[model samples]
Target: MLITGRTLRSLPVLAVAALLSVQLLAPYATAQETGRTVSVGTGEPGYAVNLFGPGEVTVNAGATVTFENPWFEPHTVTFYGDTEPLAPSDPTAPVPTNPGEVVEYDGTSFLNSGFLFEDPFQVTFPDEGEFPFVCIIHPGMAGTITVVAADEDVPSQAELDAEAEAIFAQALDGLKTTAGALAAQPISEQANADGTSTWSTAVVGGLFGPSDVQQFFPASIDVGVGDTVVWESTVPTPHTVTFPAGPPPFPEDMMDPLAEETFLAASGPNDAFGGSGFVHSGVIGLDWPAGQSYEVTFTAPGTYQYICLLHADQAMVGVVNVSADDDDAEAQATPTAPATPAPGPAPTGNAGLDGSGGGNMVGMLAVGALVLLTGIAAVAARRRTAR
Candidate 1:
């Protein structure tokens, strides 16, 4: 069904009793053992941090918190109430992360993957409450842990099913929103051999990016250094523009973990200068220089990659490679145009080559949460139905 909901109007007393039994014996049935592990990935639903792996684990009393390090970046599992301060803590602090705090489990509460990290916190929950935690590496990645009371009275499975349906509806809505934002973005803005991509790659039939500037309109483009490359959004959903190098002000080459991700407003067309631009609203209109067409142009050579920031799953990325020689060669080969202007000439639709190399790296986020989300819905439904 497009939507799911249990038809049960009432949960039987026996079912409720059964659920209570399961909840009660959970703490004692199992002897002291390994801790429960969780993860919180960036850009997840309702996450404050924009990293990855905000995984969740349910626990009874005496459950431990084991945070794993799957990503190369360093991260820590922090509590909401604790404040361990120190100098030069993360400047991106404020819901992004808590820096310089005392390590909860001898820094094992944090995982840096030093040669090989096997640190796990065996701290038992021993009570019922919600504990939210996140990855210190990516900052915003966050998730929650719920400890259920041994004697707590919970509703039947059928009652929980109804509540699951409601929350699932909200999740579907979030997907729609994310898709819309994707549709509004320029899947890519490639840097051309001559510093401008004359066509939209999709308009020309290339999948990842355009091929060769030979078939482009004007056969090339022109612009000052500070000009912008405007990409038109034809499809309205399920696409993402990603940059493997992260947003610019790009470092000479930020390879090691020790280097901070660099960002800068650098140079572009006509010998003018410009910084990197973000997908403020996803859509690109004719909002460049007064005389410059939304088309790309350049006076130099460089390589650039861009992706639909929202639809990373759809694998939308574009690469732009510009060279001064490209313009020189085109200038020597092309015929001069008459100074008269009428309707715009037909665009060749040849979105020359592209470089959106950061393939849908973030696409798996939505799929990874499906199972957990379903369980959460079942649990929450029990609450709503009982009300």
Candidate 2:
């Protein structure tokens, strides 16, 4: 029998005997625990796994499940069953959810773990059913949890941890290999008719299976004065190539659905960048009529750094090494192929421009090109009539 603290202190002899008896008769406790843990995000530098480790998990009713985030990127675990999510009042703020509180989720009410960071979001499942959850910020990131009767056997926490580790390890390994291959590619350059040269570099290379990499291929490039660098997106995700004085500026309406069309316009002066002030490509890969590409001509020589605002916290950065001396820059550059012109028709004013006068130049160029095309068409019509 277990004695009370007061009784044990009063009679040491009797307490010792009681404790010995209990210890000899008591069974050894096992290492297995009741609750389950899911790792939120994991990967090396410049790459991240948006997927929840062990995307599928099994648990018994009344058992607690914790979602832990240990990465810089923000993620949410939202359970939306046959209902659409309403627009968030504050784009940067997270939705409300109780941490460490046990809720008997039955798929009727929406449950959200808003902007999971260093803290773990805990919830107890009392109802036995299959529930699906997703990270709303990422398109294909999702998972499922199966709950059964309390008496049914389920995998222990150790087993679940091992499974999640193996899954992320395999996926991250494949992504590392793919990213390295992409980075090995050389920048392509073409000499234009007006004597200026154009250098082309790929943005966010491509997708690796279920993972989408957030890095600039060949993270560093060397270019000379009067050279134009064109960043072309090979992936579908929207990314911006921004050069700022301090931290990059993320627009308040970044997540607003209505700002879709206008958000892709280029910002700052695109005419020339002398390694000063702010320059941004707005949002690239937005299904614009002109294929995903942003150009900037460098006028002065200096070391410049740029980053993708969306993934900068994840170390999605690149370096542009510009040299005033054309010979030195050319010697440093590794060119594999010539870059073709930006495809599709000229972008209209509807593409939207920022207040920095960046869009004005693009609009003027578009109008001039349209007028020139119309005049050429009219002359061709007259020549055909004479024939």
Candidate 3:
């Protein structure tokens, strides 16, 4: 039990080293104990239609799994059997004619994350079995969690991360392709035998594929005040045409029946700010024959920005520039379509946490360890001087 000054100084060094090691291994240790962290939804360009990252995961029994949603929209992680069967439709084509149905989840007896939006939901597995889940809001999105015995081996964090990256890249590419296709379609204007011209554009979503990439054709358009513009839905999924509300108060609910009345009440020319009250088409689901169309006449002359409520974060937005000039006569004589807007670059991996917090924690820990080591060195030097 006699300890030398040199040994005492070395203790601090070892302590600092151990602390640094624990800091570095914290995430992995947590992952092993609480299963793995699967991103519920990749926000922004991809939206929440795509379920868990890696699509599938394996964890040990008695471990907890956390599902984190980085997107602003709400999504659910519900066990597959708990949900109703699909109405018999092609998975590779647009969504089925049926609208999103109500599926209940009580968090137990059924394992579900009711509605997650920018929050992490955790569930524990006590038995060894494969649990398949899907987002009730977007039934097309699915994933599975395989729970094995306590001693079973699972994919490491690096493997899961790599798989997630590849999946996200593919999702982003698909979104860009859908957006580009919709943007390239030319706006059609039918001249009525009377005089007025009806300008129309298709609001498409997964019409040609199984993706939930909703977008407004010709993202931007120019029209004279008083001209009516119609948005026809070609995809099976529902969408909303919502306009921004100016200083005056307006309801934010796009699905409200009163929303259409409010929009019509504000119809006419725009004020100085280019906004004239709020306008929303409510939820426009697909219809047979001609499809569902929502027409709005811009009374005031100003630029109006609108978005599809479901896919706004995915950048499904459109603009309407209303000019003061009356061009009904010329539009009736000869209709000319505007040039298609160029598609923007695909969204890079801007979905996940940018490592700022992790970097800050590491930096702080390193600084603390360095400070402790410096103190140990100073104590050792003092002990040598005393000797």
Candidate 4:
């Protein structure tokens, strides 16, 4: 009877233990359902390159952003715009990882900073803005996060138009002149001439002319906003004008070194207007951003200089002073083959060199005999023609 009474009392205790287990497990199971999954991988494909499975994830407040570096490369999973890195160390214990997520190399770079462990990104936005970040080692590896205010409405059409117009003006009005053309212009830049206007331009030898390339012409040039410059090459060898620097980004660096952003003008073997020098068909052609032009045109309001890569010293430089204007332009083919001198129409000494050739032999012999008496007359006529 005593054993039966003891068993009856233990039943209530057992019931209490069962109730405690339910309470502990319920919250954890709920957490997983609400949590979001972000990824950090090599951004490449194949087993060698693991990608972010979800790529992107969004969750309500108090939810977690789980990051997994599935590949061998070290990765970081940090909150954008946050002061400190995520994936903090656990003094008491190492952070636990889910299946398929592994932490590899601990390089001094940010990846090893322990910024992407099981942790909270800790921030979310209600308004629209962008957050861009990158993996320093691999170029072109970057991601952005944008948040939009739930209540904010999109901008009207007028606002968008104004923004585009502003950008258009920014790109034009900054090109310099062409290769030899800039050389001939006033180098001193003053409305008046100064000693500074003079400089020995050795690069002009490539242009074909024996005349020394003087300050009278320059290899390249740059200009301020709303200006214009031109180029005309003297060399029969086809030359091109190209600007290496790309289009303007901000207002400060708008004028790149010359007007071309890429292949502006693709001239035929007989034409001009490419980067630095002329390139044949086997070579890649010029390709610039903002826009390309062989003829003179304002390239979005900036200073630009182009030169011949082939003949550095001759056919060398071009300047385009692009400015804010509606004027149009195109790449014009350079005229005339300087190397191939054209044939003339006049008759020559060929007849005299001939052996018994061309027209009446007997009459010619008689005329030759009569020439003894007419030698004096012939001499007089020759002297008169010489005078």
Candidate 5:
């Protein structure tokens, strides 16, 4: 039934939820002069903070600074100095020298908070000097700590908290603007020559800055039975439109970096789905040249749920409601075109951080809620380049 001038009505678009809420760390008043704190990473749908909050901070000698991350994304606080820096043989493993331990600094020791570190990492500086650090996993995610003499004055803990709050607040503001644009995205559909229809949706679309979105634009859509839905990754980070019984529990199926062949290349059976077995799109998007989009045909009339394994913790989920075709149904609206974003050329070869290494590292480490699933031991080929 190819109705050229007829429009297919879609479900009412929901108002963007609190997808960008920022969790500000409460002021910590510990024994030794109440140290300052820095936010490692924060995220919500369509927005994320890649760089450290209050990227630069100043504290007096003997004062402690705690780095904390309460968001879904994982991060490492690695400090480099006179000591030659070394990345873990497995990028997913914590640095062997200081695996999950409080670090004391004299200004020259190489320090790392390891990958997927959940607990707040506290570091005390007994000597005063400017110390620079980087999240080895994420290229360009760097920050510095300026230490003054014990008697010199520095920004108080309250002041630093205010600064971090301002940074997060600004990110939230930007997220709202981007969400408005994304929520306005319409469901794209086209009637096939065989009378079946194809619907298109955006995966992690609408990037505003350095931040990578963790959302599915037009998260939900309506289609008739025998229709097909295609999910396209419009951003750089990898994502999967996977249909399992429901969102998988944390760490159970953490993306295995070694199995890039299976998870990155294979698009399991394309036969029409009546909602039983797993239908995985694998990892789609940047650097994955095999294909950057996936489609699945729905044969039954029912509601089906899907999620992006890479960002399930951030609630990167969507739904497709399929209804039986009715010859008497009338067209209620016109079809909308898919968004055409001109992303830059994909990286090739041993492209480090910005390329495959860093980008893929972030995707692999982005397992699920709170922290990386505890006690999942999998060795991944290490790539030390920045993201």
Candidate 6:
């Protein structure tokens, strides 16, 4: 082949164009090679409770299905029959009974990906079959995967992504509506003459079932650095008030020294801690006659964000804006209706509480009445002390 200088110069241009084309097509090729990556939960603001997007998916036999958890909470992808699914009323009840049950996938063998948080779990299907899975922690959360013959066509990555987007959008709208309804309820408050404030946690709504979802009565609040803020759980379900810990002025020290050390030891490294100090109120359960309350006096001035570790991903988050000016704190503090007895009966058979019998409405009512009376008496005593 007789090569001319002009032709040689054109060769470089052609090669460059080919390289650009390959670069652009790389993503699509990789998507196909990787099979399908299904997002297990939504990361959208205020709507993180979704179980899965594209609740059902189709993939070629022998293709790998990657389940990704993008939200803050932990989830699992366990095939039906792999293990007993916990009742929706008592999701956490299974953990004790089914601890460390890891199943290895062997085509016919049961498969279960324990709880996953901010990570992805992958399982390859070597045969054609329909597999249904659920998050044992949330039995109502279920999905299905259809594995067709190798030659059958499956939904592409683009299609799955679009479907996920739509699902998340709809979930976000539902969350906003639920949150707004809860927000409309008058927050119960009892302001002290000493300039402290308290906010109660309420069962706002449920994700999988009744009372599964909860949030801070006043999701946001303002206070002075020296002022104390207290959070009391008003429901039987357990919850934690957790602030990401890291950087200077850790808020853990603001709590009891013993509690702070205990939390640090259990929480391990604060790799996820951005700048705020880590502070956690260990599992507040119904058995705590004191109403499972936690109080922290802000030592530094800034906007601190916190969450109920159990329901954080479900948008159960709150914020506290601390200022140096007492006047500013008092002005910004949310006003609330006077404290009153919470209407609903407390959950039954909670391990901490009496645990006499399941669904003890009368027992629950008695407990509620006791709590209401205690709150009233405490307020009166505080007023007397102040006088």
| lDDT (tens digit, per residue) of candidate 2 on 79-114 | 776667633222422553655465667776778887
Model 4 residue runs over 4 Å out of place are 1-31, 42-47, 79-130, 146-387
Q: Candidate order by lDDT, highest to lowest?
A: 2, 5, 3, 6, 1, 4
RMSD of each: 19.8, 21.3, 19.1, 34.6, 13.0, 19.4
- Residue-level lDDT for 327 in candidate 5: 27
TM-score order, best first, reads 5, 2, 3, 6, 1, 4
Q: Given candidate 2, what's the lDDT at residue 344?
A: 20
Give the TM-score (vs. native) of candidate 4: 0.20
**Candidate 2, superposed: residue stretches over 4 Å from native:** 1-32, 84-94, 97-101, 246-265, 269-271, 286-291, 332-387
Question: Backbone clashes per model, in order?
Answer: 52, 0, 6, 60, 4, 2
Taking the tens digit of each residue's C-alpha lDDT, what string does model 5 give over 169-203? Answer: 67655654565556555656677898877776655
Backbone clash total for model 5 is: 4
Please, what are the lDDT tens digits per residue for candidate 1 over residues 234-295?
32111222233323332221211122221111122222222233222212212211221223
Superposed model 6: Cα runs more than 4 Å off = 1-30, 45-47, 80-82, 86-108, 117-119, 191-217, 222-238, 242-280, 285-387
Residue pairs with colliding backbones in model 5 are: 7-333, 139-386, 139-387, 353-386
Each candidate: what lDDT?
A: 0.30, 0.59, 0.52, 0.28, 0.56, 0.50
**Model number with the top TM-score:** 5
Question: Which stretches of candidate 3 lie above 4 Å from their native place?
Answer: 1-34, 45-49, 80-108, 204-211, 246-275, 287-291, 310-314, 326-338, 343-387
Q: Model 4: number of clashes?
A: 60
The numbered model that scores best in lDDT is 2
What would the TM-scores of all predictions be? 0.34, 0.69, 0.63, 0.20, 0.70, 0.53
* Lowest summed lDDT window (length 10), candidate 1: 205-214
